[model samples]
Target: METRKKILITIGDPAGIGPEVALKAFLQFHDKAIVFVGDADVLSEAAALLKLNLAIRAVDSVSEAIFDKGILNIIDVGALRGLSWQKCVPTAIGGRASAQFIRCAVEIILNGGAEALVTAPISKEALMLGGVYYLGHTEMLAELSGATDYAMMLTGGRLRVILATIHTAIRNVPDMITLGRILGVIRHANTAAYMLGIIAPRIAVAGLNPHAGEAGMFGREEIEEIAPAIEAAALEGISVTGPHPPDTIFHKAYNGEVDIVVCMYHDQGLIPLKMIAFDRGVNMTIGLPFIRTSPDHGTAYDIAWQGRASATSMAEAIKMASTLRLPTWR
Candidate 1:
């Protein structure tokens, strides 16, 4: 029997449903070794509120964890005290705690202590409030892990969409979408598909303009930028077809016609993905040195403590993180 790979899970915000969903997922996959990196007190409180008698064993190190069924091993960061699950709030302490837990989980993956990482939803505002100056998890992970060119790929069962530009202003997107950027995203999409065990991944690159520029009648971005980039990627031996109409490409990809769709902009890709699999989507970061994925949704502050938050996305993320097997680079 092979040993189960340990996955480092970070509970993003104690005040949010991160702890709850993580606890629930762990309970469901009790056979796998999951190291929860967050406030142990917060997890215990959330478990109590949900009427779950889960044993959160605090371990000093990941190796010390006894991989057993029906038990959760935690690498407690000691972020909160007297954690109240019912009265959860977005406090400075909570924000700082979330940042610290993320840092710890990333470190564990980098140092080879964990096989993969699944981060819960974090608040961009709270993260900034905690004095960490980063837009979101993708940026922070890139900087921390030294990943220069990384793309965000959202996966929901059948549909997979990769973004060219993420978390940038709508007006600034045009300037940022260059030939290099488009090719980089396509390359990452191919690599991500391969990691998911797909050989010779077929990628459909979405055009920036309507109707794929309608032969330069609608817009010149596809004619001048996107089409050329796709041509360049094809010459490199990647199975890529390109400059497809953004509107219809996602529909085809969702139906399994294409392995992945490389979208030109953020909303151009995410709008359809969120519509189809908002609750079950997993946001995976490609071109990173380490494997990193998160649930598609955000902190969901309105339903943080109501026990109304669904764990399906988080559960899918955990399962994906566990299944991803990276190759040994020479």
Candidate 2:
């Protein structure tokens, strides 16, 4: 009985701060429409624990959602219906619940029952323990949506970065940084920049070694792989540069000198972004079959259910995805 297209919000891990922050975030959007695709009971528990003033309604499908300001319409996946949630830690039940919620959300999105997706955070360890094979959201979403060349792009204020590699061991990062890999990520970055309304964006590629490999003094990745990727991208009409000092490219991006930076690995990009927008950054998956965004941070198990988790990032994720269109991830 829903009258409008609703953006679907998936509560990540019931045991973490996902459910609590989800309730807090959606409450800020009185004018925009959204629906929760997770446990109705868990949402109720979060609402009661947080002293949130709102009406929670359970529905069987996306069509049953109602777009009212004070009422939250939820599709109860019931992964943890009668069980108690062990807050602030990883549990098999919590992991299974998280997987189910995300799987259900994918179905709704593919079926056109929703407009876009705003996901809460989920734990990789919990997911693997629960028999969900993927390491993180990007990998899981890529597989489920058939997204082949997808990349994780994080954005905050004027800073934006896409990772050449994510969710992998640091020891294995160097071996993975091939010319093809860097080029693919740069193309994804170009697509992402245009998606964000940046026409002719200055894309920067961060070097794998210090001082951008010091012109082969520190490493050859810059002289051989990184620079080649940048040149190839530029030849294809992308305003790209780099092999810049890994230490300074982020600062340049922060000051708006570059629109998007293709980082060599995970922490290289996230460390800088989180420092700038810890409570407001948005994690977006570029080249997905559908538009998907999430809070830049993960499920805060340390402060889970304390009602201390900030909802600004979650709200910002919803706001960001709500305005985006389906990307051509070719």
Candidate 2 overall lDDT versus native: 0.87
Residue 121 displacement (Å), model 2: 1.2
- Angstrom error of the Cα, residue 169, model 1: value is 0.9
Q: Which digits, one per residue and each the tens of the lDDT, describe model 1 over residues 1-330?
A: 437887899999777889888877777787677888987777888888888877888987898887777577899987665553334556666678888898888888888897788999888877777787788999999988888888999998688889999998888877877889999999888888877999878899998888988999997888788888899999998889979988788879878889999987788988888888888999999878777889998888878877778999999999898888765550
After the best TM-score superposition of candidate 2, give how far the Cα of residue 28 lies from its true spot, in angstroms: 1.2
What is the Cα-based lDDT of residue 204 in candidate 2?
89
Which ten contiguous residues of candidate 2 have the minimum total lDDT? 321-330
Which structure among the candidates has the greatest lDDT? 2
lDDT of 2 by residue, 75-119 (tens): 988788788768899988899999999999998888888868899
lDDT (Cα) of model 1: 0.84
Model 2 regions lying over 4 Å from their true place: 1-5, 328-330
TM-score of each: 0.95, 0.95
